[model samples]
Target: MHFVTGGAFNGKSAWVKAYYHMEAEAVGNWFSGYRGDALPEDLHSAAGVIVVLEGIEQWVKELLMEHDPKSAQDMWHAALEKWLQWERGQQGRVVCLIGSDITKGIVPASEEERELRDTAGRVFQDTAAVCERVDLIWYGIGQQLK
Candidate 1:
């Protein structure tokens, strides 16, 4: 698994697509929470060698709003484990997760927004832990974080 994170419009998704040479013309293996795509239930039968899941912050906001913090986090971690297991099931399979960096120095004024930020920070930490590699994007440059 590879985790990529940076501020919105920082080129993380473009970098990943270029890095992987993601050329599929159709909605073959690329998915995004921004596009309303749910986290895949299983990658066992996915058609491509790699899958890209972007807009993780959107997913986190949805989950954090809908469920208790612990429960939402558990669901997220379970999905990650499921994807990671599927990636390991095939020798060449990869799961690339792209999240916009929402955890920053300034805190949100609203309690709800703060909660979302807090949950997303923990979620990103957990994602970094499970991923084999991590990258931080700025402008158009990508720096390996792990």
Candidate 2:
């Protein structure tokens, strides 16, 4: 699994798409690529899975309020459990793409934004910890971490 991250407009999506295309071509499956809006059944057939999430903050927040009153951390734990269950059922790799600008200014000026930033950071950290490798994209360049 791989975790690819970057700030706004950093081409994280493009990078992931390119990686998938290149890998497909290298393996002689030139037709394979990301289908963002349409979840394909063949996602499990591939050797790995790449999940591109644009708004980690919002999603986590929504999940927290799914049943109301619960904190984001609780929701994340539940979501992780479900994810693990699903992962166990699939023998492919899973990659997650999330947006993050690690700076104080990007940290958000409102309570909502602050929560988002914090959740986004936590999501990135957790995913990266489980992934085989992590990459940071900036100015169309990729820097590998771990």
Q: Which ranges in model 2 have alpha carbons more than 4 Å from their true place?
A: 22-51, 64-70, 102-107
List, residue by residue over 1-146, the lDDT tens digit for candidate 1: 99999999988877997899865522658889989888776876578688888888899888987798788789899999899888988788889999998989789999988888988989999999999999999997999989
Measured on C-alpha atoms, candidate 2 has an lDDT of: 0.54
> What is the Cα-based TM-score of model 1?
0.94
> TM-scores, in order shown?
0.94, 0.64
Among these predictions, the greatest lDDT belongs to 1
TM-score of 2: 0.64
- lDDT tens readout by residue for model 2, 29-65: 1121222222122333444444444444445555444
Error of 2 at 109 (Å): 3.2
Per-candidate local distance difference test: 0.87, 0.54
